[model samples]
Every structure is written in structure tokens, then in C-alpha cells.
Target: MTPAFSLAGISKRYPDFSLRDVSLTLPEGQVMGLVGVNGAG
Candidate 1:
């Protein structure tokens, strides 16, 4: 099996928001959903 989507060693740094070592995977014939909200800055 292979991953349809993936992220490795991903990092983001900021004065307000930060994401580190984020990873994800979606197999074949699968659905993915991403939901998020951003506050006013």
C-alpha cells in the first residue's frame, strides 16, 4: 500500500502560530477533510 498524501519533517514557526513535525497520509480510494478556523490578527 502507498500513501496518497503525506508530509514529513514539516515545520512552521511564527510569532503567533506554529506547526512542527506535522504528518498525514491518505490511502488510495479515500477521502480526506481539513477544517480549520483562523482568528483575526
Candidate 2:
């Protein structure tokens, strides 16, 4: 079955912080959470 939520080829860039080639998939009937602690600039 296809995913309920899909993310691909995600990236973020900054002089102090960066995130590259990030990917995630939340399948159907599943719960997911993204947490960032002190991960802010």
C-alpha cells in the first residue's frame, strides 16, 4: 500500500546550521512525531 504521508529529498541550509537529504515516510494508519530539542538557530 501507498504511504499516507511521504517526504523525499528534503534539505535545509544555513551558515550556522544545516540539514541535508532528509527523508521520512508515515505509512497509512500510523502516527509519527518530529521533535527538535535546542535544534533551533
Candidate 3:
């Protein structure tokens, strides 16, 4: 089966810091959350 959403070896550069290699998978019909320290965006 395939994942509803998937990521591999992802990275992003930000003004404060950098997001190193990250990966995740979301199955179908599942909720996901993204949070950071101090409610950072």
C-alpha cells in the first residue's frame, strides 16, 4: 500500500536555522500535527 503523503530526505533553510534531513509518512485518513518551540512557525 502507498502512503497518503510521504517525504524523504527533506531539508529547508530558514533565517534562524536550517532543517536538516527529515523524513515522514502519513497513512490514508490520518491527522498530523507540526509544532515548534515557542509556537514558532
Candidate 4:
């Protein structure tokens, strides 16, 4: 089965931080979550 959602080559940048070449995929009937601290990002 194909993925419910897909992401590739994702990136984010800040004067003090950066996220590069990030990728993720969520298949059908699946769940995901992402959490971070108050200062994360």
C-alpha cells in the first residue's frame, strides 16, 4: 500500500538553528506525533 502521507527533502533554518534534509512517511492506518521542548526549534 502507498503511504498516507510523505515528505522529502524538508528543511528549516533559523539564525541560531537549522534542520536539513529531513524526511518522513506515514503509511495508511498509522499515526505519528512529534513533540519538543519550549525552546526547541
**Each model's TM-score?**
0.64, 0.70, 0.66, 0.76
Candidate 4: tens digits of C-alpha lDDT, residues 4-35: 99999999999999999999999999987776
Q: Which stretches of candidate 1 lie over 4 Å from their true place?
A: 38-41
lDDT (tens digit, per residue) of candidate 1 on 1-41: 99877778899999998999988778888996776565332
Clashes of each: 0, 0, 0, 0
Q: Higher TM-score: candidate 1 or 2?
A: 2
Who is ahead in lDDT, 2 or 4?
Answer: 4
Q: lDDT for each of the candidates? A: 0.81, 0.86, 0.90, 0.91
Per-model RMSD to reference: 3.8, 3.2, 2.3, 2.8
* lDDT, candidate 2, 1-41, per-residue tens: 89999889899999999989989998899996666687552
Better of 1 and 2 by lDDT: 2
> Which candidate number maximizes lDDT?
4
Better of 2 and 4 by TM-score: 4
Off by over 4 Å in 2: 38-41
Question: Which candidate would rank higher by TM-score, 2 or 3?
Answer: 2
| Model 1 lDDT on a 0 to 1 scale | 0.81
C-alpha RMSD (angstroms) for model 2? 3.2
